[model samples]
Target: MGAVNLYVTEQYLLLKTVDTLQQKYGFRTLFISDARDEFLLEKYDRRINHVICIRRKTFDWSNQLKQDIDSYLRKFYQQPQLFRGKETRFSIVYVSNLKPVDSWEHLSKTMRLKGRKNATVTTYFVDEYEGLEELGKLTNTIDKNDNWKMEALPPISEQERQMVYLEQKIVAIHQHNQRKFEEIFQFGKTKWTFVLIIINLIVFFLMETQGSSTNSLHLIDWGAKYNYAISEGEIWRFLTSMFLHIGIFHLMMNMIALYFLGEITEKIYGSKRFLFIYFLAGFTGGIASYATNDAVAAGASGAIFGLFGALLFFGLHYKELFFQTMGRSLLIIIGINIVFGLAVPQIDNGAHIGGLIGGFIASQIIHLPKKTEGTKQVVAIIGLITLMSAMFLYGSQQTSASENPQTMAAIAQEYVESERYAELIDWSTDRIDQGIEHEFVYFYRAVAYLETDRLDAAEDDLFRSIEINEDFAEAHYNLSVISERENEIGMALEHVRKAIELQPANEQFKQYEKELSQKSTSG
Candidate 1:
C-alpha cells in the first residue's frame, strides 16, 4: 500500500515518513501555501500569494497558482509528449496544498497525467490550506478534527465522496447563517415561503388532474403567462404563472431552492419585502417572457431567482459576512444556474435573468431588516424602479408583438375546438390588428371561417397560411378538408398526400389520406 503512491492528509511533520519513502523511490517536496502575502512577483508587479515551490531552494509563487499548475502538471499527466519518453526522472512527486481536478473526468483533456515512466504524484491538503470544496473537487475530506493534533490516517473509503458532498452542503448552509448571535435570534419568519410552496403544490395537483403539466393547453387555462393574454388586460396571469410549474421535477427543484433560499431571504428582508420582491420579480419575468417568447410558460423559477438576488443584496449590505463567508458560494450558484440555462433546452431563462434583475432592484427599494438603514439610497432605489417601469410600460404599449401572437393562436384554437366559431374569429381579427400574422394565427382563423360557412374567406386564409409556411402539416390537412367540402377530389387528394408525407406517424393524417383516396376513386 505504501508503494502504491496515494497519501491521506496529515497534521504533523512527515520527515520520518518521507525518509522511509525516499529510500524506495526518488521524490521531490514542494510546499505550497494558499494564504495571501503582501509580496509582488519580480518585475510583473503582480501580487504574489503565500505559495512557495521548493526543490533544494525556493521559487516565488504567482497568485494564479491553478493556472500555473494546470500546465505544470501536464508534465506529469499521460501524453505523447517529450517528458513521457524520458527515463531517470521523477518516480514519485509529493505535492502539498493539493493541486485540484486530478480525478475529475471532465478535465481529462487538460488534467490527465502522463508523466515520466513509473511516476506517481501524491497530494495532500494541509491545516493552513483552509480550502473550499465548492471551488473544486478535493480528496481526503473526512475531517478527523479541526485542530492540528497529529494522528495515524485511516484508509481511504468510498464514503469520503458522500462526505465531500455533505461538507459542501454544510459550508453552503453555514454561509447563510454566519450572522452575529443577536441577529440569529430575530431571524426573519418564513410564513410567505411556506405559503408560496403550498400554493404551487396545489396548482400542480390541479394541473395533473386536468392534463399533462407540460401540455400547452392545460398551462394556458391554468393562468400560465401568455403575452397576448396579458396584453388583453389579463394582468393576473403574471402572478398566477409564477406559482404554476410544468412538471413534478420542475416543481420539486424550485421548491427545494425556495426552501433553502426563500427562508434565508425572507428572514433577512422580512415577510413584506420578501413577498413584494417575489411577486414583482415574477411580474418582471412575465414581461420579459411576453416581450421575447411566444410560448406559455409556468414556473416559480423567477421568484426563486428573486430570492437569490435578495441574498446577494444582503451580502452587499453586510460586507464583512458576505466577502468572508458567503460571496463565493452565492456567485458560484448564480454562475452555475446561468450556465445551465444557456446549455439546457426548453428552460425559461428569460424569466430567471429578468427575475434576478428585478429582485435586485426591489431589494434596493425595500430596505433590509437591519439597524442601519439608508434613507437616500432607498429614495434613489424607488426612483430607479419607477423609471424602469415607465420605460417598460411605454415600450410594451408601442411594440406590436407585445400583444402576444402565440397566445392569440392558442386561444383561437381552443375556441375552434369548442365550436365557438364567432369568438374565434373575433379574437383572431383582434390579434391580426396587433400585427400577429403568424402561420398558426392564419390557420386557426381559417378554421373558424370554414366553421362559420365563410368558404371563400376560409380558402383565402388557408392559402395565406400555406404560403407563409410550406411545411405546416395541419395547414395542408385542413386545406384538404376544405377542398373535399368544395367537391375538388383531386385537390383534396394532393393536399392530404402532402400532409401524410410531412407527418408519417400521424394516424389522423393517414386516415384522411385514405378518405381522400376513396373520394377521388368515387369521383
Candidate 2:
C-alpha cells in the first residue's frame, strides 16, 4: 500500500498509524510524501533531489512506476512455483495521491494478473478536486470501497490549510536566506554579544544549583521577577531578574537572541551606552511587569526587546545601512516573535513593551562622543529623568493597590506570595472602602477576581480601573485581553491600540494590536 504526494508537516504520527493498520490487516505499507515531509522520506530516497526529480517528471515518472509494478506482478503470477518458496501467499498493492487528470486511466477493470489467484490492486484517488464542479465532469467518480476497490483518507479541511500556511511562513524566516552563524557573528562587532551570552549562561548554572530554574521558588530566589517579592522591597530584582530564566530552553533562546542582537547594538551605540540602555530597559520592564501582572515572570526577553528598539532607532538615523545589512532579517524575526507572543499564553508582555520603549527613548537621547557631546549628555539626562518620573508615578499608584499603609502593603504582598488571593482581595476592598479609587487598586482586585474565575467581576473591576486612570497602559492591555476572551474582537483591538499609544515602545501591545486588528478584519 502507498500514499503518494501527501502534504503534511510531521509524518511520524501518520506513519505510525499506517504501520499499526498494516500489521493488523497483514499488508506492507509505503508512503510517498511531498517536500515538506522530506525528513521522513530521507532513508527511502537515500539520494537528495532523486525522488523529487522523479516526482517532477510527473507523467513519465508515474508511468515508469506503473510499468515496474506491472512487470513485478506479471513475473510473480507467471512463475508461482518460484514465488511459492516465499512466506506470503496473498499480496495487495495500494496506490494513492494521484493528481486529478481526466486522461489517466490510473486503474481499469481489464488490468489483471493471469494465473495469480491472490493479487489485489487498489487506487486511492484523493478528493482534491472539490469546490470546482467542472473537475467533477472530468472525474469518473471512483466510488470509495466499491466492489472491493478503493479506500482514501479524507482531504484536509480549510482550517488545517491556513494553519499549515502560517507555520510554513514562520519556518521560512532566515537571516538573509539562512546565513551561517559565523557570518552573523563576524559581520561587524560581537564582543559584547558574546559577553552577555556568557553572563546569562553563568546565571543559569547557579540557578540550577539552587534548584531547577523552572521551579517558581528557585526562580524567585535567583532574582527571577517575582512580583510580590519586589513589591515587598526586593528592588534589586529589577536589575538581577533580567539575568535569570525559568528553564533551560528559555535561557538558551534568550542567550542566542542576545548573541544575535547585542553585537550590532553595542557597535552602533558604543559599549557604554549599550550597557546603559540594556539596564534601563531591564529596569523599566521590571516596573511594567509589577504594574501589570501579579504572577511570577522572568527572562531576558524584555532586554532583548530593548535591543530591537535600539535597532529601530539606529535604522531611523542610518536607513541605508539598516536596510542593507540585516534589516529584513530583523523585521522577520521581530514579527514572528511578536506574533508568537500574541498567539500564545503565559508571556510577560508588559516587560517586553517596557524594555522596548526604554531602549527606543535611550537611543534617541544617548549619542556618540562628538563635538556636541555636552548637549547630547544634557538631553539624555533629561529624557532619562522624565521616563523615570513616569515610572515612579505608576509605582506610586501601585502602592494604593497594596492598601496605602506601608505595613498593610507589606502584609498584602505577603498574602500574594503565599497564594492567599482572597486575603489580597479583602485588602484591596478595604482600601476601596476607605475611598481609594486608584486604577492600581482596581486593577489588583481585577487580577484576584480573574484568578478566581469571576469573569464578570473582573471585567467590572478592569473597567472601573480604566475609568480612574484613562492613561493606564496595563488596564487597556488587560481589558483588550478580556475582550478577546469574550469574542469582542473589535473592542479588543481598540483597547490594545490604546495600550500601545500609552506605552508606544511596548512590543507586546503592538503584537496584540497586530493580531487583533487582523482577526477583527478577517472576522
Worst 10 residues of 1 by lDDT: 36-45
Clashes of each: 5, 1
Error of 2 at 153 (Å): 72
- What digit string (tens of lDDT, one per residue) describes model 1 on residues 360-423? 7778777577654588567747765774476457535645434445555656766766687887
Candidate 2 segments whose C-alpha is farther than 4 A from its true place: 1-189, 368-380, 399-523
Residue pairs that clash (backbone atoms under 3 angstroms), model 2: 353-506
State which candidate has the highest TM-score.
1
- lDDT string for model 2 (1-523, tens) is 2233343311322332233233322222222335432111101111111000011112235565566456545644553222221121222222223433444445422233454443333222222233123112212222122222122333445435544544344234222323433343234454667877888889889878866776665566577665545655788888888888888888888888887688778866667878877888878777777776556678888888988888987677655445545666777787787778767667877788778877777776675323145676577678767876677557646754553333343444555566778977986897788676667777877877777878788889999988887898988898888889899998888889889989999999998898888888888
**What lDDT score is found at residue 139 in candidate 2?**
21
Q: Give all TM-scores, in the order shown.
A: 0.59, 0.42
